[model samples]
Target: MTEVGILGTGAQVPDRVVSNDEAGAAAGVDDAWVVRKTAIRERRWAAPEQATSDLAAAAGSAALRSAGITPDQLSVIVVATSTPDRPQPPTAAYVQQLLGAVGAAAFDVNAVCSGEVFALAAAEGILTRRGGHALVIGADVYSRILNPADRRTVVLFGDGAGAMVLGPGRGARVRNLALHTFGELAGLIEVPAGGSRRPADQAALDAGLQYFTMDGRAVRSFVEDRLPLLTKQFLHDSGVGPDDIRHFVPHQANGVMLDALFAELALNRAVMHRTLTHYGNTGAASIPITLAEAARSGAFRPGDLILLAGFGGGMAVGFALVEW
Candidate 1:
């Protein structure tokens, strides 16, 4: 079997900063109330002209530069996002054009917040089979899909993108990658219209069904009930102990959820890297964005063990174990 590992990582957030005070005011709440609930102080939102592919291209370019490779060298480009520029063209295709990655196979995957992990797994498999470089990006522009007046959803999302360049290497080998989805819980977080199941008609638009909606409490309960079981089984099957993990990178869902997971798993807070307080939740971009931030800050070192886990809207969950 071919060994695939990450060659480089990069992240990019928009320049527009939306502070908690501003968001809270827009949602008819106080800043303190928002902070107390989500622990998010601020987040970035893309400019009017910027789209998800724009962010993905920027991050992917940075990752290519960091990896000391050019776009033309890429064999594949996989983008994970729910927010595409248009419904017709895959976001990755736009990213590929923006990056000038000629001849690279490009596509998009939508697993909501768990998207990055899913993309990583896909890229790893591609490299193993084709023995070439793959650029994987996780990006989201939730600001466009969110209902500004809905504090429950609006306060928890931001726009950003993160990317990784992977190839056959030995820097940080991907040990285990697993993904699962529960469609029954899919309605817990979703856009009620604009899809095949519910086409975007004028009635849907008038009803505000195009906006994102989530059952915060139900989602929390789902995570609380499922995370422990999944983590336990993943660790057991991978023969990795909680103590062996030097870094724990999870989807930046929220601070409260992280706290609950930490307590339930009995993991050290020092080993967990969090970016939510500053970035809120960037949906699919969260994991790679957090990982890149941590990596740049020297939070990871050679020979350290890292565990990446994420759960999201499809009621999907994904895990990846690596030895750095």
Candidate 2:
């Protein structure tokens, strides 16, 4: 088996800062309390004109640069996002163009917040055949669709992007990947009326269902039970125990979600590095965003055990065990 370890990672947060207070004023939350609950002082909001592909391109460029490879070297480009620049053209196409990935085939994947790991799994499937290298990018600008007045979604999300390059392998790659979804809970955190379920129009807008909504209490309960349970399940399935793993890179859902997960895993907060406070939840971009920052900070070493996990809409969840 080729050792398909991660070659490099890159991420980009937006330029403007939306402080918790500012977000609170806009979203109707207690500013100080929001900070304490989520450990988010502020978050990056993309420029009004910025598109999801733009962010993905920035991250992809950085990832290719770090890997010392040109875009032409890649065989595939997988972009994961729910909020794409356009409803039709796959967002990855634009990113490939920006990265000069003229020869690489590109497309998009959508699993909401679980997008990064989902796309990575797709990348692994292609490389497992011993044929190619790939660029997996996750970028989202939920703020664009968000109703600025909606407190639930607005404050918990921001714009950002992250990417990683998957090289040809018979290598020690992602050893195991598992996924689960329960569409029954699809109503928990979702943007109703946007798609076929209830097509958006002047009527849906008047009904106030055009914006995203979350049954916050229900999602908290869902995360509380699943996060810790799945982490342990993944460790066991991979034949790895808590002590055997060097790092836990989880989806940056929110600080509240992290606080619950860390406690359940009986893991110290220090053992699991986080970047949610700085960028908020970039949906599928969260995990890789943190991974890119950690790599640059020298937080990882060769031969380290890495666990990448994510969960979000489609009521989906996924995990990947890799040797870094």
Candidate 3:
């Protein structure tokens, strides 16, 4: 089997910074409440003209540059996102065009916040057979779908993108990957309208069904229950252990949840990487964004074991073990 690995990583966020005060004002809360609940001090909001594709393209370009690979060398471009530019065309199409990756096959993956790892697994498989580089980007513009008055979600999400270039190289070698989904719990986090089942109409609009909604308590319970078990199983199946991991880069869902998870996982030697303090939960962008920041800062040592985990809507969870 061909050995594929991450060649580079990049991240991009909108210039507009939305402080907790700003996010909470309309949500009937205050900065203190938000910080206490989510540990989010601020987040980035996309400009009116920015969309998911734009951010994905920018991040992809950076990844390509860091990898020293030109756009035309890309064999595939996978964009993992839920808040796409439109309901029809795959957002990867726009990203491909913007990046001038004309020959690369492009598509989108909608595993909600778990999309990045899903996309990474997909790209890794393709590259193993196709023998070329792939750009995997996770981007979202949650600010567009959020309900201003919904304190549970509005204060927990932001707009941003993160990306990685994968190919046969000497970077972080992917050791194993795992993904899971609980379809029955899909309703725990979703936009109730605008899809085939619930069309966006006047009634749905009036009911505010188009906005993002989540059973926050239930979702938290799910994570608290499943994450540790899954992490242990994943490590065991991969012939590793929690203590073997040097770094844990998980989805920037919530700081409080992550803190608890970190403690429970007992990866005592591992340093948990988090960007949610300022970026909030940027949908699928969180993991890669956090990973990119750490990589750029010279955080990882050669041959270090790194774990990437993401869990979110679709009630899905994805994990990837990497040798950095």
Candidate 4:
């Protein structure tokens, strides 16, 4: 089978930090209450003028720099974003132009938090059959859609971007993609704008459902009930056992969720990567951000086994097995 390896990774975030106290002051919640429950102390928010595309461009440039590749050399640009800069031009086009990848097949994806993995699969598929370099970026300035007055969500989300450079098969890099989705729960969490189902309207704005909301308790139930089964199947399909994984980077939605996943898989403590402490939950950008930081800091060994798992809106879930 042809292989596609991640050549580099990069990330970006705005200057603002919405701490629990700040969110509490804005949305009426106790700082301690926020910490005890979600385990998040602070989250970043984009400036009023900053758009999601700005983040994508920044991270994409960083990835190109790290990969030692230039914009003109890129064959494709895939940007994964549920929160787009505008309704018309796909965010990828801006990134492509910014990176000087003028003639590439640029586009955007809408897999919510599972976007990074989704874009990864798309890039892997494209590179496997065709021959060219592709850049995958997941950047979200979620606060634009956020109701600044809502506490549950305003405290949980942050703005950031992450990028990865993908190309022809490299030695034991990304082995395969184990991606899955459950559309029935699509409404569990979503934005009702810039799409067919619920086009942007005064109605959605009035209802205050245009931003983000979640059945946290319900999603937790789903994770506890389904994640184990999914992980097992993912492992079976990839022909890799739990014990073989050297590191686990599950979604950064919450610390407790990650703790549950790591303990369930019996993964070692040393290799687990967690950046939520400093970056908070960066939606689709979390994985690449952590991975890039690790790469830059020399955190991985030649024989390490890395697992990437993410869960998000639409009840979407995905995992990838890689040898680093």
lDDT tens readout by residue for model 1, 1-324: 578988888999999999987876778987798888988889999999999999999999888887888999999999999988888789999999999999999999999999999999988888888788999999999999999889998989999999989987646778899899999999999999998999999999999999999999999998999998998889889997777878889999989788889788866633888998988999999999998898888888898888999999999999999887
For model 3, what is the error of residue 156's alpha carbon versus the real structure, in angstroms, after optimal superposition? 0.4
Per lDDT, what order, best first?
3, 1, 2, 4
Indicate whether candidate 1 or candidate 2 has the larger lDDT. 1
Off by over 4 Å in 4: 169-172
**lDDT of all predictions:** 0.90, 0.83, 0.95, 0.81
lDDT, residue 15, model 2: 95
Query: Residues 69-97, candidate 2, lDDT per residue (tens digit)?
Result: 78888989999999989778899988888
- Candidate 1, 243: how far from true, in Å? 0.8
Which candidate number would show the highest TM-score if scored against the true structure?
A: 3
Local error of candidate 1 at residue 266 (angstroms): 1.4
| Candidate 3 C-alpha lDDT tens digits along 17-107 | 9999999888799999999999999999999999999999999998988889999999899999999999979999999999999899999
Error of 2 at 127 (Å): 1.0
Candidate 4 contains a number of clashing pairs equal to 0
Q: Which residues of candidate 3, in runs, are more than 4 Å off?
A: none
* lDDT winner, 2 or 3: 3
Q: In terms of lDDT, which candidate is strongest?
A: 3
